[model samples]
Target: MYDFQKTQLEFIEHIKDPDNKPFKHPVESRRMDIYRDLFFNNIKGFLSSGFPVLESLYNEEQWNSLARQFFATHDCRSPYFTDISKEFVEYLSNEYELQAHDPIFMKELAHYEWMELAVSIRKQTQKWDASKTVSNVQMSQLASVVSYQFPVHQISQDYQPTEPSEAIYLVIHRDSDDKVDFTLITAMTAHLLLTIENNEQLSIDSLNTMMIESLPQLDAEQVIQGIKQIVEQMIAQEILVPYSISE
Candidate 1:
């Protein structure tokens, strides 16, 4: 009598360990190897496509080694191919560490590279009118609006420069076309976006007031223009969609 749960666990354990006792027959052994190869290859392909810049940054040997390590260690939650990249990015952020003297921009660069594909595959069936919503709709912002405190744009994956420069703030968002777009934002702009996303109720004027106080160096007129420009850009990108209209 074959116990399904026990058999699956045993198979998993066997696949993970090279020195483990071999499974039953020639057929079983070959089948298990196929599964193991497919699993690793699938994950590697997904991650490589998602982080092309990172892939190019590292040599083939280094990239493959990192992929193998991630494959062995990360406990992926999704069986879907699309979700694998998300998990890989999370792993890179939480677990993977480059050299101590390695460019601080590396992490952000990996993330920036991943965003293009992430947004490209994102499901965005919900339709919202930009002009209408910005005028009268009540909306909730997304938590995924991340800003990295790194000058990632200046870093070239092809030409690894060796110097530390001032950090740049980045804003990554999925556009209306479902494409991911990245922009450099000021600290105040990043904060304003976070506040709106968190509170979901700050009027444009209120946001400007907060910006004025936060970025005193920027005059109110400049701040207003900047805010308008950002809002327009977000709308164009489809990051900001209409929520609900109030009577």
Candidate 2:
């Protein structure tokens, strides 16, 4: 009798290889072809939705070529269909780069575009504190939050007319409603968020003082207001979970 597991593995290998001898279906060869086509088309459709902008950027030939390459190279770990996009994005980050003069902005553009789906699927585990004091609070030590080096916020695949003269900054987080929100943030704001994540004990006033010195363009009032706005939004969206209130 055939070892079911080994037989299944052999069948999978056969299906993946166009050169391999076809599996003898009890029914007919045409049925096997139909199955093969269905498998390939389903994966293609899933990838297309995951990387819409990337698909639009490249011609059909180029897009298919990349997809084939991705399929062959990456050993996806997730069994769930929804996680495939995350795996594809991870592949791009590790293995792909824009061709010479192709578009310096391509990498960031892909990242910015991918964030929509990434944030939508992200599972948040930490609880945030709403009443925590902001003044003099240490702002550098939160792990749940993510920060990126690229100025990805400026390029809009849909709206922007001309390329930007300067780099952009962005922050992406899941709100309370389970919706992903992307916001353009300043270097100081980014730094402040990082500080909060890093330091166990921080004061709100000290954070403000640091922001004023770190970002010379913004005055104290503007910085304070900006922080307040972000905090409120974060709280409402559930990005900032309630931890503990200070006395």
Candidate 3:
């Protein structure tokens, strides 16, 4: 290995985790400390902003510990600063070891928060004509349907629940005006959205029929009316866009 390359790797390792990976290279302690603080603080600041709710649930020391763990261990793949939050979410979902102090809903809450940021910055590839009454409907690129065991949307420092509740469903979407918001939805609505999202060229009428068949206990007319209402509401919120058959 090249001398300079080895030195560079050692420097990064020390900066990422000073406590464990001590700097063995020829560098002044003051210089290394400055670099360590700069790098760690930058990462910590972004995490604090990205997961404000999660941060609030912990004390400053606890939050810093969590952030440092992510910095020291997770191998982030994205080069963009905006993607750090996503990397943190990935770490929580796949890599983080649950500490007893950690909330049970930590992973879900992190995901819920990240989705808001993700939807806000997501780029739109195609424009929709809201006036067009197209038969086929598809979920918008900027919209996401999520289900969690806890009511992630309602969780806060004062109201953290110890036990999981019934599965909660939510739809997060960005409107044409570029405002991001989420709506609490029923399990049935969640099912309908997922069905549309997974299928191509599925019309609302077809979905209504499928729902009626699946939920035979409900009156057919009532099911049709409920689906119609949900479809209209979703269209108005830009969660469901009119899909053009030509495309």
- Winning model by TM-score: 3
As for model 2, its CA RMSD to the true structure in angstroms is 5.3
**If both were scored by TM-score, which would come out higher, candidate 1 or candidate 2?**
1
lDDT of 3 by residue, 1-247 (tens): 6988988898899899999988886788888778999999999999998999999999988999999999999999999999999999999999998999999999999999999999999998855754567677888899999999998998999989889998889999999999999999999999889888988788777888888998999999999889888988998889988877677
Better of 1 and 2 by lDDT: 1
| lDDT at residue 243 of model 2 (Cα atoms) | 48
Query: 1-247 in candidate 2: lDDT tens per residue?
Result: 4677766766665455434445553547777678666765667788899767657767777776677666656778999888877778787778876564234555555666677777777665554554545343332111134344444554445643235454455667666566666767665556667766665555556656666777788777998787778655545544444444353
lDDT of 1 by residue, 11-48 (tens): 66555443454454345666777977877677788778
Determine the backbone clash count of candidate 3: 0
Task: Give the best candidate by lDDT.
Answer: 3
For candidate 2, the TM-score is 0.66
Say which prediction, candidate 2 or candidate 3, comes out ahead on lDDT: 3
| Candidate 3 whole-model C-alpha lDDT, 0 to 1 | 0.91
Q: Candidate 3, 233: how far from true, in Å?
A: 1.0
